[model samples]
Target: MSTLRVRPSTVLFAILAVGGVAFGTTCVEACLGPGRAAVRLARTARLAERLQLTDLCLFTEARYTRHASQADRHAAFQDHPAALEHFPSGSLMPPSGAANRASP
Candidate 1:
């Protein structure tokens, strides 16, 4: 009687190949899944347009930094001109155009 033996390297390769296949399947599903939601997304966009909605809010920590266009450059340092930003989002977004221009 002959016994079949699998090498450790072979087992590892087989596991990796299975994982690769699973990852590829997920990618394909993701690519195809968004098509089904296209209509719903379009409808939502139309609703937003009709309502004259503002830009999307990126942060919830502070009202000033929530929307890039609506940000108040001095709001972060309201307590003191040299105070460090209290909200983490302040570090993520750069100063808005109004802040960059020199006041005449």
Candidate 2:
């Protein structure tokens, strides 16, 4: 009887693939439920037109200037739902002075 042996490269590739899967699983498991729910609730791209959120979304997720801190900004905006019409209750808050200043 003859046994076949795998090459070194194949072994390395297999290890990397397993690592990637484990890492992805860990992330998904960690982010499910509340983390996922919060993202779904707080991700405002769908509200862009109705809420005039395009500009805000751009700045909120923008790359270089890094004006927004994901953790703190999400927390701040979640607390200040008044500026967003799509908030769960669909109740609106009158634009504050800062919001009014940006009015077109």
Candidate 3:
């Protein structure tokens, strides 16, 4: 009968691979339970909305000032009414007299 030979390095590698997979599986299961995942999604969506609001405000301010055109201002205002409602009055507008200065 021929003897079966198992190399030490091969056995060690198999054990490490199995252990790593198990550890990864456990971590994923614990971190991303259905409820936990949903909460994380909700938080991410809210953060995205806040960031989008900031971007819209900045863009509207730039368009309103640079062009000094009422059509562009109206178009930008119509784009994000919800963001406009969120901020206090004059928060997004340039400081008094700032927009009127012509760039050299």
lDDT of 3: 0.56
Candidate 2 TM-score over all chains jointly: 0.29
Cα TM-score per model? 0.70, 0.29, 0.30
Q: Which consecutive 10 residues in model 3 have the weakest lDDT in total?
A: 66-75
lDDT score, residue 99, model 3? 33
Give the top-scoring candidate (lDDT).
1
Per-residue lDDT tens digits for candidate 1, residues 1-104, read 98999999999999999999999999999998889889998998898799886656678777767766666768788789998888898888776767666783
Best first by lDDT, ranked:
1, 3, 2
Residue pairs whose backbone atoms clash in candidate 3: none
- Scanning candidate 2 in windows of ten residues, the lowest lDDT window is 62-71
lDDT string, candidate 3, 1-104, tens digits = 99999999999999999999999999999887877789887887798787763222333334453333332324335557554522243344543343345663
Clashes of 3: 0
Off by over 4 Å in 2: 1-3, 33-104
